[model samples]
Target: MGKHLESDGPSSFSRDTVKAIISQFLGFLLDAYDLTMILTIAPVLAVVLFPPSSSLLATFNVIFAYSLTIIFRPLGSAIFGHLGDKLGRRTDLIITVLGLGITSALTAALPTYAQVGILSYILFVIIRIGVGIFAGGEYAAGHPFAMEWTPYKWRGFISGLVQGGFSFGSMLTAAVLSLFISTFGVKGLETYAWRYLFLTTLIPAVIALAIRLSMKETPIFSDLKAQNKIRKSPFLDLFRKPYRRDFFQVMLFMTGLFFYSYSLFAFVPTILEHKPSVFSLSTANHIYTIGTVAAFFGAVLFGTLTQIVGRRRLALIWAVITFIVSIPMYYMLMYGASIGNVAIATIAVIIIGIIAQGPWGMIPIYLSERFKASMRSSGLGFGYSSGIFLGGWFSIYVPLMHEYLFKSIDTPTNVWFSTAVLLMIGAVIVGIGQYLGPETLGTRLSE
Candidate 1:
């Protein structure tokens, strides 16, 4: 038998164990905040980071930066996943957080295009790439580290709560952006207010770092180390026959998950900001904030459900729901400015949030359960980042399709229709994968 360490028992946790959990949750929360913050300010970035001489280029650049970060995340995932698996999750996590914190601060300090011309845009892309690199590892390391430390019975609950931390970040970004616009107006938001939002990333970074520093490595990983079960090359092993199936299955699920969720949260904001839009920028932000609240609860609910019904079943069910409702919901969001239409839009997005994020609640534990501690981080990180990398490429098509398919028509209809098609396609892919995937509820980490 492999060396086994005691799991964190149900009743109590040592102070350091508690600190580690908190840090992981916060790390996820902050990672979400940092990534979504760019989407939050896409409207402003279009204005401040690009000259008005060509609105099309400005719009493309905004999506480009967002897509670039998502696409580059795999590089970070592969590199850090290797390090986390070989060295230690805690050690690599600290390094990743430090990189993300520094990048956010530097991004806030960048000059606007009005002040520095195209060079400003170049700097922004560079910083976003840096963010992606660090971001790639935050959850890949954090999820396995946290799940491995918890009791098996509470795994679903803890996983849901921590994954919901992402929604918390999404909600926080909307709330903060609303506050900034209220204080500064649109012009000020474009000029100075946007910088302050990037600066806020530092808060969670500091909090996560402090907690991580105080904690010991997880009991599961420690036990593996004691037995010398750690692999010399976990990254390569992920592609070998034994682990390869789970690796690709998880990637497929995430490809669908990231594609729909990113389109809903990140791309829609730009569409709502278009002229003759049904919702004003402030109103859209409010709607997103509300939808994210629903998403958090949805995540928790599904996380809980997975324990009873099984992970594969719950994922398949939600995948079907997302596919069915995605298009109709888009039509509702594009509904005209009547109060009735706005109400429909609001309810539609809230439901979308629930369906879109529900399956993610089980993802952390599910992915963690698929591999042994010897290479869990590497396997999970590469799969997660690779799926996100591929899914993110869809964002480029959003603006391109809108500009081409419906250039003469309304922009909102164009975006909603385009993104809805993408979401449906993703849902179908995930549903097929989930049907063929294994169910791993109540499995112990060291199994």
Candidate 2:
């Protein structure tokens, strides 16, 4: 802690730190926009690509594609994580941005099942896998790059800026989808509007790549590499010494975070699907748009809060609030609520955004501080990527569980009650986890 305090002295800020934060923020923005665009468009795409009777199947197909991506994310993270550590963060960042952009563009050109038969599905799966792999690399590099560049005193705020980009991207996606759908008839959207959605990824992807290209490797990683202090087996070494307990704690914390995140995100759209009266496609999308906007501000607010109060304290407070609010907020949305009611529900969603989503702002720093620079990339990559795997896949199963096993969607009340119960459980887990976690504010990168 004394070393951490020393590192927090006046010399911490630099022009390069600003560049790194902006570059990583842009990359996250693009990733978020692309991912959310796909999620928002899935329902509409189902109506377009599949037979009318197979709409549900189409929804499942999209989910399956997403599941494939989630499953492969860790592999991408591990592969690129090593590259980021051994080669350079800048190198990996550039490659991932270009790869993700190219894959997204290719997705725009893919034919429908009607046109290509089974080949369309195959192509979709392959494209998603490619995107998933690149996305895996993006986070592995992006977070560390931002953390390594910034001083400890402002790490939470800078990291929040990076995380905030995701919310902005989501907001941008919702706006894009809304505009496209409004302008193009649903039939027209099915034919060509979706293609434009894919094309939009190209702009941010190119920008992120360019920004990253101009940036150098983190001073921290560079210094470590210069000393030949790189770990021979970073994954193995992550648990070998002082890092073992911290590693496990971060892993558990991340797992709870992702579980609640995935569950909330997956369930929201599905629940919207079930409640046409309250959430027509347009209306539901509007809710998502508003929620994303809320998330953007929430991230900024929480990030700033972390700086003032410390990361661990902020996380614990927000997590408890999220847990208490989960059930009631969701129940309100489940019944035939008005748009205004849904808007109110956004308050809870915003809090979730702040707590579950906001802690990620500090994660890059938290993980980096937990390990030496030699193993930082591998530790952060493995921990965060593994959390995504567990949380991401389990979320897919939640919809399936509710739809097939519980038969909860049979009635409005059942749907509300079931989702509320699931959220309650997730909220409790996340809240407790945060309380027991370490506070890494002002931690030294070189420690």
Candidate 3:
């Protein structure tokens, strides 16, 4: 505890702080919109962008588009993290939102396979990488920007409030896409509905960008600037002495979250859609939307609880719970014979969402508290984005593993079982990481 330990009323925070948090929340919505929409629309993209001549090529095109975005995120993280650390979080965020909005608009209007042949697929991927780069900068700047402005006492709750914005975005994307598909029908969705989905992302991006531009620099960053103590190269400094342990710990924490969340949210939907006999696309989307909405509230609840239970202990408890419940939950969801059985399965998934994503809501504060103001943005950015990029790749391999290892016993039940095993592994890893780290609930951010 230091000068920054003083408590302040919620209203004591300046308008700039409130505005910045709102902008960050909106930016998160846009980020989730693009990523989730890509996964949701993968089947459509495969049919429209790839030649219908071969099924293998179609799968490749869809997977390639999704994977490229995940792979390039870290590159964007490093680049934008440097700029954010040097210039300012606000300035870097402005550039990131603009890039996301413009690139998304362009991709929405991209040519179909019929018009441009292979060039259509090629251009889609190139622009997807661009979107990933822009998205890379968003959280790196936004999280630190929001967390740095809050008082120590309220950090846990506010961190959950801010990060919970991600679940809102996920729910919105799923709901809207489901509505669009229902209105347009499957044939129409493949034809033009997908284009409009990307186009809609521009609205939030522009609005969030405008609010960000109107906002002031974070109080922490401003104070550092006034003292002339800001690092000239904070990105490099993140890997040097003193800061390395904090960076690594946050990286491990985020890695477990990415593995757990991405596997359930990203991997499950795709698997369900591809196996239509087991679940329709719209049904899958509805399940995801419902699950994420529940998760959002879970995040808020768990985030608040961190203040009482301690961050490390809370994370460990949730990890173990998720690990134990995963297999039985999946078995119910996959093998149930009646609608009641399906309902139970869906409820099981929702429970997993609650515990799995709950700890994440506290991450912004935890990460922000770990670094000095000089390199906070860069360190958080690199650690968070790099963890996600690394953990996200497992989604790519999961499909292949399902195809090869379980080829003989290829059933929906087996697929769900495989998902459970991965979730269990994620829980074990997260629990161990939390055990290795210190309790950050009472730690004070450097002023």
Better of 1 and 3 by TM-score: 1
**Candidate 1 TM-score over all chains jointly:** 0.93
Q: Per-residue error at 69 for model 1, in Å?
A: 2.6
Cα lDDT computed for each candidate against the true fold: 0.77, 0.70, 0.75
Of the candidates numbered 1 and 2, which has the greater TM-score value?
Answer: 1
How close is every model to the real structure, measured as TM-score? 0.93, 0.90, 0.92
Question: After superposition, which runs of candidate 2 have C-alpha atoms over 4 Å from their true positions?
Answer: 3-12, 54-57, 239-244, 336-352, 404-417
Clashing pairs in 2: none
Candidate 3 RMSD computed on C-alpha atoms after optimal superposition onto the true structure: 2.7
Please, what are the lDDT tens digits per residue for candidate 2 over residues 175-236?
88888878996667888778887898899888877777778888777887888887777767
What's the lDDT for residue 192 in model 3?
85
User: Candidate 2 lDDT (Cα, whole model)?
Assistant: 0.70
Best by TM-score: 1
Stretches off by above 4 angstroms in model 1 are 1-14, 53-57, 336-342, 403-414
